[model samples]
Target: MSLFRREDLHSLAAPYALDALEPPERVRFEKHLKGCDRCAAEVRALSEDAVRLAWSAATPAPAALRDRVMAAVRTTPQDPAPQDTARAPARARATQLPPHVWGTQPPPRQRERRRIPLFVPFATATAAAALVVASLFAVQANRTQDELTAERDRSREIAHVLAAPDARASSGRDGRGRTIGVIASATEGSAVVTLGGYGDPSGGRVHQLWLMRPGAQPRSLGLFESDTPLVATGLGTSATSLAVTVEPAGGSPQPTTQPIVQLALKSVGFGE
Candidate 1:
């Protein structure tokens, strides 16, 4: 006989073997297996293996844990008194008080009383919600200030790499003897890198720029789209140099090829 015509049953076999199937699926699978001898045998073997694995992983629970759990379970539950049943008689008595007080007054013209407005619980809840939302926004504003400080530090590092004199110049002829592009204008926080007249690399390879700071490793700025100008981001304060290299379709942790462009940045007024 065919092993369980239901595709869902076959999908449930592994979970059933592991005892992870929910109640409905487990019952249905068991019914299906009664007529399918091959599936039944396979499931039996898998179940045994699962039991063995669980037994190997089993460890004794702490002795006090079970006692504490049972103590909590044995506690009696308390029910609250119903509000309407408790308040109905009190409301009736309060209404009677007004009538008795009116009888004791000297005259309607001489006795004057003002009714106080009742408080609305919903209005109080709405005001509380508004206060909570305002507090959350205030916290977010403070977090943004901290993020801006970190971004400024990154910008300073990128500026340092662009100022190096020994950095590889982006000028020269390509393999085809045509003029290759040159990267120019290196500075702290921002730099003007060049993409030249040569054709872009093939096979999904793209150029990537990096900011290498003194005592710190290089960090990726972004991918350099072929035929587009080079720009960098996240330059930290006191960054000493810049490098550009060929990377995979996405880019890698380190430069995979020689840097096509390089620039050195100066440290002057970096902290400011």
Candidate 2:
């Protein structure tokens, strides 16, 4: 019975292309490759990736490391020659042989057989290294993709708010003349806050946003560090304006400092 199933054979293409399979497995996979177009194509693709990855990651070996390896190679002792079994006395050979002239029996002290060594071609070694680096690249690419997806979703929400029929914008400047603007959409019940030239919040603090009302505790919108635009949702009709205050890092549950910048939302009929 075959040790590998049909589906199992396909998985060997990468290792085979990389010359990482054992001799027996290699022979079986080679037989499968002859009849499997999909496996053949995959092998070709993996081989190509291996080649490209090798060239991209190749670096000259350090002189010190190379010198050390060469020194070890030169100083290493060669293995002693194998014993001459034929030189053994005739009396010993007869005892080790089968009793009958034509019989097949085990010898008393047969030489130990050595396993065929695994040989990795230079190209395949490059492929193995490439596989390691490729895994790392794949992880980074996935993280970058996730970031792009998040940014895209945020942009869509901001666009939705800006395109509302009742959308209106309010702008004001801080004591330092850094501009802060809010576009509130009554229909969408959300606001997009934009900042310009609003350098670091400074003094180990973060810029916090609040929704202020006549007779209510200020509602926290979120925290800001840079000039990145933020979208604040749940803009109820009672909120009169948006305010910015500098608070300790990580921000506070409530406003700790007086407002440095405020943009009245009345223009968008938010408090009405």
Candidate 3:
């Protein structure tokens, strides 16, 4: 049948389980339930939910409730449906009503019991959507973890180089007279530099660091985001100059402005 018709059948599961559907609608849905595994499962679950809700609201009935009900029954005649021929006694109504209501006897339209396996397309679609969301979250978490790990590894390496027994460290004033500090490994070009009192950059500008050897051209380390210390690996061990210049926010191929502070090393020192 059409998809809309199938969805309609699924929609009735809750009302059907609660005995809220009209007799004819109930009969139609029961037929749908026999072949539609999803509807049957849903109806069964809804029925259980209803039972739990009912029990949660349960309390001891008033002691005189049965007597009061009987008195009301004795004085009041039951109203009958206009379509029903004659009202059956309460006990006989069980057999007289259609199977859709009482469900004690087989209805003429469907007598043979048929087994249908449970497979719900809607439930499958929901599960797939959940899996996709979960996969996305897992991938994001892994990427965040990797970024944190890389930062920690960088910090450790910087600490090791600065703590070396043979690591040479020096502090002096730049042309700006702002304090500049340097600690370079004796065996390698591994180094850490600290800068302070160099105010913030103007809009569209960033501070860049560079290393210059005796006769070689100055090499760019990278852009600095903060006045905090920075670590540079694989620098020239013979470098005698360190400089910071204001450049485009992303930095430049060469210095775009005069150095904010330039420290010319007396010696690229420490025992080598």
| Model 1 stretches with alpha carbons more than 4 Å out | 1-188, 267-272
Candidate 2: stretches off by over 4 Å: 1-147
lDDT of 2 by residue, 1-272 (tens): 77999989989877866667888887777657556656765776676666776699889989999999999989875432222122122222222211221122122332322100111222343333222211111112123545555544555566567667777777786543357777778878898886654555767898888989899999999986355567899888888988988889998999999987888998877888
Q: What is the model-wide C-alpha lDDT for candidate 3?
A: 0.56
Q: How many pairs of residues collide in each model?
A: 25, 0, 0
Model 1 Cα lDDT, one tens digit per residue, 195-214: 44333567889878787777
By lDDT, who's the top model here?
2
Give TM per candidate.
0.30, 0.45, 0.42
Best by TM-score: 2
List, residue by residue over 114-194, the lDDT tens digit for candidate 3: 100111122443333222211111112123545545534544555556555556667675443356667677566667776
- Model 1 lDDT vs. the true structure? 0.47
Report the Cα lDDT for residue 12, model 1. 64
List per-prediction Cα lDDT, in the order shown.
0.47, 0.61, 0.56
Model 2 TM-score, 2 decimals: 0.45
Alpha-carbon RMSD to native, per candidate? 32.5, 31.0, 31.4
> lDDT-based ranking, best first?
2, 3, 1
Question: Distance (Å) between predicted and true CA of 235, model 3?
Answer: 2.2
